[model samples]
Target: MTSEETEEVVETTTDSSTGAARITAAPYMPGKTFTNMFEKYATDGLPDVFDISFFGNISGSTIAQIRSTMRYFDLIDDQYVPTDLMKELVGTDEETRKGLLKMMVEEKYPDALGLSQNATSGQLAKVFNERGLTGATVDKAISFYLHMLDYLSIPYSSHFKKRRPSSNGGARRRAAKKAAEPTPPPVHTPVKPKVSTEEEQKAAYVQTLLDLAKKDGADADLQDRIFDRIEKALGIGGGPAAPTTTGGGTTDSP
Candidate 1:
């Protein structure tokens, strides 16, 4: 069968559990809820077997939400065992963990991330509310997601951060004035010219050959031949360039 047909079949089968039709009605859980679950699993240790009862005091629906989120992130395998990603997350340094989490969110929750980018919690909450999500639930979810962003040191809308009230209200007025002011046109800096040294030029030539080989579907033997020709032409590997006699003067053919 053709690759496209094979892909379509695989997608159709996979979608039986996690397809668009199924996802549309999936429960929405905030980023904070996910982080909380991760922390719980870390502290208590992820059980070898999946057990709804392991989540003490948490509702069955909440457990289901957590499980769905985990599955969506590919953190758990078909047998519910923690995947390599989950193990890496648990063993990695804080910065590495944050990077992994950020990547996960970008990959799995890009829509929500895009909505939240440069938007205040209230603005994000409004978007969810418009989509028929409960106000309280939306607020909680947005708050949690924002918290996750902060933990990851990812920059977001500055308006989301809490500001102290100015005693004289001067700071607020100045901020408003600044916002009202027209932005200045950006200045373009002239690029400095780069001069490639002899070694750099040789390196660039070699790279060009490699790129051409890749583009032309060169086999190992063809690539080796190309490299051999280059070496011989460059007088490398004890090979000297052929000398040409032009106007009774000898010059290397290069």
Candidate 2:
């Protein structure tokens, strides 16, 4: 067939199982069109133990093959694999690898086959009918589930190894809150100077008066006289006597 005829035939056979509305041919490539390979190989029933065991082994092999294929496709850069599940599988003993994959498939991807631990085949079959969990998308679903398990393991094992994150954001927030709050000012005791006793005060007063008298200035003498007058008026002696008057209007001169 001519290239045009081949293109037309390819276009006619294209299928749309995913969300896209139409299937299109690969640009500039004849007989090389997109296909839902996942849907093509996907199954709704839980796989039996034999198939489970086989696929577990198959996945590891496929992972290696995919890596090799990706290299061929020039897709390898930096690191081809993020998580080491594939690498672990490659290094692990076949029996252990099989058991691990089986456990994962049984626990997580049970609906893909009719052999899950929790749900019966009939129940899963009904779910597949209602939700249309076709075989084509099973690989993606499985990959997604395994990726989630790996994510969970990363944090879990890090904690188990005591590699906790250094910065606790919650603790930081609490500290910041404490810092933001207003603090009460410190209470301080007032210092009191030593006070003189009454006797000490009287001695000081007498000294001040004597000092004023000895000072040669007129202002100093005036201050001394004022203080002396105050002392006499307070009945300390030398003030004129106050005269007494009788209520009968007669005064006796003494």
Candidate 3:
């Protein structure tokens, strides 16, 4: 071969080898900051040429692969892929940065898509209990889902209903009825009758004895004799002057 032809062929071969060894970096994820770069790329818009081959020659298969990767990682899904730009915009950490990429790759190629990658309603309580997680964890997962939905700007009606508590229907009905019933009123005590004092009765008895002694006579001698007789009969006079009476015989003051 001629020297010129040999040189040209050698250069050509070198260029081809260099091209084969070339490795491109991945592009920023799509749908960041409400910018639809994936759509634009798929529709033949060249935003920038660097690492463009990683997102190469967009097609249905490529889109599906991207979506699958995002979903598997629990970061993005078919409806959304948060861009690295968005992460930068939010100023998150390196862990999150690496995590986002890793998630995207996993979603692209999931081994078990049927299992609970993201928490679902029916699977939430079961998975939570299995993992020894709390209801708060499940609530956080739901909140995450809602945040993603909002980020996607997906419209949902406020009137949307959720599943009722899972328990016996009859038991639930009975509980509802019991809760609705009115409570009974409290009972009150009745008043009692009034009673007389013992001191009053004693005073009346003493007064009756005094009145009887006064009616004995107006004369002092008669009064004294009547008082003495009454006192003797009642065994109230003291010492030797007191009278004694027994069933066997009559007795006088000693």
Candidate 4:
């Protein structure tokens, strides 16, 4: 059936207590043990009487508790025959079965189940004791019902398994080492000198003027004028060679 249909079934199915008092005399039965019993019953049908041998080599008292617990939940009839509810549960899907089980618990034992849903077994015991119910017996009953609920995938908090401590000591050491180490300084790249297009043009002009001045038969005065003009355009103060004497010596004051 669809989940919605299953939920409708659960919602419609009410308590079938038949004026019978809720079972509070049984010890807590593990969810797996109850599952085993249901599986066996589904195959072989309900037994004439509670039998420890049928379940494991468990105690006789444990067997009686299991039987009483089953009856209290209305899973079996007075004749020890599997009821219609048990029959329906036998082959239902997991989610549907859980829904049904939750509905059954809520309807049949509203007070105990409602209280257990929010409180621990010990805390629930105190509340039940105030109501004149045997605290220990009520505690065990709450535990058994809670286990069944858990097995059926109902949302209920229970004792959590302790987690083991991690053993990656080397990883922790490496992490500590990384944190303790200092950060390195950032790297800087050296800047290169740049020559502008204007400077390049001025250099070419100076070179060309010098070459012209060095040519054979070039006029000394003309070469001096060209050198002076080139030096001025290039932002330089020095002029070219001064006029030479007929003996090829520089004319300087003695």
| Local distance difference test values of all predictions, in order | 0.58, 0.38, 0.40, 0.57
Worst 10 residues of 2 by lDDT: 26-35
Candidate 4 per-residue C-alpha lDDT over 17-130 given as tens digits, one digit per residue, 9 for 90 to 100: 665344333335565777666566667765554334455776656655665556656776554466777777766765677788778766755555565444554555554454
Candidate 2 stretches with Cα past 4 Å from truth are 1-82, 110-122, 134-254
Per-prediction TM-score: 0.44, 0.20, 0.20, 0.42
Q: Higher lDDT: candidate 2 or 3?
A: 3
lDDT, candidate 3, 38-73, per-residue tens: 334435533332222445676644444344334333
Rate residue 234 of model 3 by lDDT. 51
User: For this target, which candidate reaches the highest TM-score against the unseen true structure?
Assistant: 1
lDDT of 3 at 233: 43
lDDT of candidate 1 over 17-133, digit per residue (tens): 555421122125666667665566677776775555466787666666666556666777655578888877866666787889889766644445566446765665555454444
- Return the clash pairs for model 2, or none: 38-136, 39-136, 42-135, 43-135, 45-113, 45-114, 46-113, 46-114, 46-115, 47-113
| Model 3: pairs clashing at backbone N, Cα or C within 3 Å | 68-107, 68-108, 69-104, 69-107, 69-108, 72-107
After TM-score superposition, the amount by which residue 168's alpha carbon in candidate 4 deviates from its true location, in angstroms, is 43
Q: How close is candidate 2 to the true structure, as a TM-score?
A: 0.20
lDDT of predicted model 1: 0.58
Give per-candidate clash totals.
0, 10, 6, 0
Colliding pairs, model 4:
none
lDDT score of residue 48 within candidate 3: 33
